[model samples]
Target chain A: MKGILRSLLTVIKNTFIRSITVLYPYDRIIIPYNSRGSIRLVVDLDTKEIICDGCGECVNACPLKLISVEKVSHDKKIKNFYVDISRCLFCGLCEEACKKDALKMNFNYELAERDFSALRHDIDKLTEYAKPKVKEFWKS
Target chain B: MENRKIKDYEEIEGYDIYIEPQFRPFGFPVGLYIALKDGVIINIKPEFGYLTTGVEKVVEGMEIDKAIPFIDRVDSSSAISPELTYCIGLEKTFKIDVPLRAKFIRTALCELSRISSHLLWLTRLANVLGINNALHYCLREREEVLHLIELATGSRLTPNFIRVGGVASNLSPRFIEEFRKFFRSFRKNFNMLKTFFLENELVVNRLNNLGVLIEEDAKNLAITGPNLRALGIKKDVRIDDTYGIYDEISFKIPVGEKGDSLDRCIVRMGEIEQSTSIISQAFYKMPEGEIRTYTEDINQFSGNTRSHIECPHGELAMEISIDEGKITKLRIKSPSYNNLLAFSRAVLGESVEDVEVILTSFDICVCEVDK
Candidate 1:
């Protein structure tokens, strides 16, 4: 009988507490600065150039073999780089293996799309999602 | 043993009751075949493993670096175990000593994962028992743990943070401070949760003595983790194997008297407290140093090594045979594979309606077994 009353009282106390449910698409919560969401190319801070030299380190580093890099020039400069985000585990190995630090896992997580074609991101699409390093945000 | 009795289905009359593979419990696909005699279960022929990824086949012939991510994918709920186990195996095979700071960080992350997994199990058990408030509270707590994980590892669910020699990144001062705040309030919050569930009459009445697993049976059936611990066994892989810096830390292994469903749930609850304390201790004693030591060339490595990690579920052991730095053969023994066998025996003589509740209490994840 005491246990029942205690449980009832606990429930009554909890009823007035704030709800933890996040109303997605209406109100947004800040993801942590280090949160890994989507893989993207990095930009050199000084040069303002997309840092990828068409080197295929990421292509080799990818666990699922989802990344493909094509060389189109005599200097072995990259012509096309494709990442099938649909098949990506988002493990961030490609970002870590980039010798030039030219790849990063960005914080923009809203990647859901209706069409499967939209999920396969090319180099241009991947570069557009790139932003400054998370260290800059950490300072603020 | 005096009270144990296997009911005969031939004598009892009732509606032909059988929940097929389609209408399974826990909203997951599992073949939990049970025969009910007058609303009571007469026999259970458990058929698990619907979703098999064949990770062993995938890892063979793959480079050691690439295989860590796939190894982490084996059990999503406890993602760190297989990754850590595989890395530890590589380190042992190649003769590499990990840094002290890295060992502390690995232990902290593992304890955090255990807490998060237990919270998830608590929510599932509460939902199965029709306790809405407990579900909300457990989910709320779990979200906080996930945020802490995200702060340290960049990803919340599948971090793949631990590498061969050390963790991927060092612990930031901000994360350490936020973790202190979390640690301060955790005990209080967990106590309230315990009071609501462990002491609640409804939960006790429904869960107590439902599926009793004797200690002898648990050992003979190859049961591990909280399921085996609930049967009054003081055997924990952390203490027995003394892996990592676990030999340096001080924590109690909570053991149960009767191996019932309620005991299983309580044992997990006790473990959450122990894991929290262990994390706090690991943080306090953490030294300032490099997180990782650069290993020598990978291509020249050769050896066959086996590693065991105390996962949230149980001991996850992995054997890797490396030839010229390439994985030639791999074998994984997940705890869920053995726990499912014990689950098949535990669910016998239980009613049809209470099947989901009993199963969740043991915290047997079907995907882990299938992996």
Candidate 2:
């Protein structure tokens, strides 16, 4: 019985602490480094060209089959890449299967779409989601 | 009692009370039908399968890697347990040894998931019992655990982090630091929970000796995990079967004198402390190594293997057969499936008012049972 009274007092005391609620839109959490928010294409640093050779590996590797890569050149270079974000599971299988590491799961999580067609994006919109990788180091 | 004609009592079965399949607490659709005689529940039947996703049939002939996402989706609350079981089955079939780092990570995640799942159970119970402030406190603490999970695996509920031979990635040092902080503070919160809820006279009177399951009955019905342990039966998958570095760790399993509703609740409270210790030990002994071994051939083995784990609810088992890079057959036996049977048997002869208290005490996951 005394323990219960002590607990009640503790609860009442703790209620005076400032609320930890973050006001959304005014305050937001810093997204982590390896968060699988959205899928994007990785561009090569040396050459001003896309790294994917349009081999359709991501298309085949995708469990949901939400990806399709089209070729416009005779050399099988990727011209247009379509991704149905609605059907994507964000499992990172496609990124793992990519031979050239051209595909990556990015950290941009604000993916609300007003229309269904807006969820289906081509190469340009997908590439725009990619941001520079944040350097992560383990605390010593 | 039999000769008395009660109000609204049908001629066929004394008083046939039916509850339609509705969305119940804990976000699962379930229904209950009971026959009461003189305010005592005489007959009870639980209805389920309202949210079947046909997950088992959908994963047929799926590639080994692709089927994991579906496996992880089997139970959102206990996602890591099913995924870990699936990966263990596949790894056993392929004759691959999981690294020490991966094993430690899996153990830590499994323990954290247990803590969070129990918190969810308590949250729903607190809300049902009108302990609104306790509900918020439980959710607040549970949110801390979920945040730690999100920081580690990038997603809160469905991590999909466990790979076949290892984890999907390495854990950052920040996760360890945060986990230590949470671990230190969780004990005080849990003690308060015990004092406020478990030791309360009203709660004890409501829960004590309401739904009793005998030791023989528990074993005969194949009840497992904490539910079985609540009957004073020393049967745990982690201890009896031994998996995921649990054999290396030293932790005591809590058992109750009589398997009543209150006993079950107390046993779970005991388990939360045990899981915290397990996680701390696993984190301390964690070694530095590769997170995953990129196996080119994951489906080289064709034989079927069954993997079982001591999930938060109870024992969860999975059987997977791989043939040439694809899963030919898959079967899952979740703890809730067995606990539901035990629930039906235990709830008999209890007062009608104690139905919800008895039901929540079992910690039955409708998604796992229905799936």
lDDT of 1 by residue, B48-135 (tens): 5677889899888888778887887787676877788999888886888899999999999999999999998999888888888788
- For all predicted structures, in order, the TM-scores are 0.91, 0.91
The window of 10 residues in a row where model 1 chain B has the poorest summed lDDT is: B3-12
Q: What share of the true interface contacts does candidate 2 keep?
A: 0.46
After superposition, the stretches of candidate 1 with alpha carbons farther than 4 Å from their true spots are A44-48, A75-77, A129-140, B1-17, B25-27
- Go through the candidates in order and give each one's DockQ: 0.60, 0.38
If you score just chain A, what TM-score does every candidate get?
0.79, 0.79
User: Residue-wise lDDT of candidate 2 within A35-128, one digit each (tens)?
Assistant: 7878888887677578888888888888889998889777858789999998878777888788888888888778998899999988888776
Which candidate comes out best when scored by TM-score? 1
User: Which pairs of residues have clashing backbones in candidate 2?
Assistant: none
lDDT of 2 at B138: 91
User: Scored by Cα lDDT, where does model 1 land?
Assistant: 0.82
Give the TM-score comparing model 2 with the true structure, all chains together: 0.91
Interface root mean square deviation of every model, in Å? Answer: 1.3, 2.1
